[model samples]
Target: MALNSKDTAETLILLLNRSGQGDRAAFAALYQATSAKLFGLALRILHRRDLAEEAIQDVYVKIWHHAPSYRADKAAVMTWMTTITRNRCLDLLRSLPPEHGLNEEQSFDEWASDDLGPLEKATSNSEARALLQCMKQLAPLQRQAIALSYFQGMAHEQLARQLVQPIGTVKTWIRRGLQVLRSCMGAL
Candidate 1:
């Protein structure tokens, strides 16, 4: 049977719960369902195929261990997993050596994009599409600020310096942009 959003979330919850009990099959199923989206998110932030691969692997190991702690009321499965992936990528990026390609001068170009290519590949869910739609409506700078802060994991001070704007301005852009997103999302 085809699964709606509710059904899909329920299945994921079941899989997570089972995996917490050390069910390898359910864990495998969960990984199969989520790894692409999670990997895409990692790749977007890390900007290296190898690092993204490493991050995905590490995130799943944590997921396998923390599956029991997942509280459905706190977040949906995808949101929870995405949080873990984002955090892991940030951690990996932070610990990278100067020999690695990462540096303070790295461009904010990736975060500034509204391309739905990654999202399209990740999921065709209505909510995902709606978010993309809302994101499209944001001013480019607002999008850039939000993306850099969220995905690239830059602090307000860092973003201000990187963008050559005042710190308050950077914070304002992010706050206002998030407001717009929340309003737009609620409307949808």
Candidate 2:
């Protein structure tokens, strides 16, 4: 029988709770169930298979370490995991040389295929589209600053260095961009 999104989410929560208690079997099951989707997310962000794989490993390690602290109220289990994976990939990206990191772009269409199940994909696609639309509404520099800070997980100093702007200017751009995004998303 197939599980719906609620069922799947419930199962993941159970597994996460068990994993929090150091249940190896539950952790393994969670890994088996979610790794592909998480890997796809990492690959989308980093645009490299090897780096994505490394990010997945690092993400899982952090997940294992941090499981006991999981709060269902804070975010859904999958959302939390995806956040960790994305951040790991961004960290990897930051560590790379600028020439290799900023210049690479691979087709994400192939990376997403069959990785996220149907319902998950549908939900993700809608959310991604909404975010893209809101991003497009920003001024070019504000959009760029926000993307680098949030999507790429760059610090203000890093963004300043990369964009050749002052740190305060980078911070202002990110702050104003986020405020605009919040207003835009709130209207949706």
For lDDT, the strongest prediction is: 1
Off by over 4 Å in 1: 1-4, 98-123
**Which regions of candidate 2 are displaced past 4 Å?**
1-7, 97-99, 104-125, 157-169
Which residue pairs does candidate 1 place in steric collision? none
The 10 consecutive residues of candidate 1 with the worst lDDT sum are 101-110
- lDDT by residue (96-180, candidate 1, tens digit) is 8746544655565544655756644655677767787788778777777777777778899878877889999888888888899
Q: How do the residues 21-111 of candidate 2 rate in per-residue lDDT, one tens digit apiece?
A: 9999999999999997888778767877898888899999999999999987788888899888877888788788876645424322222
Q: Give me the overall lDDT of model 1.
A: 0.82
CA error at residue 168 for candidate 1, angstroms: 2.2
TM-score of each prediction: 0.83, 0.68
Quality of model 2 by C-alpha lDDT: 0.75
lDDT of each: 0.82, 0.75
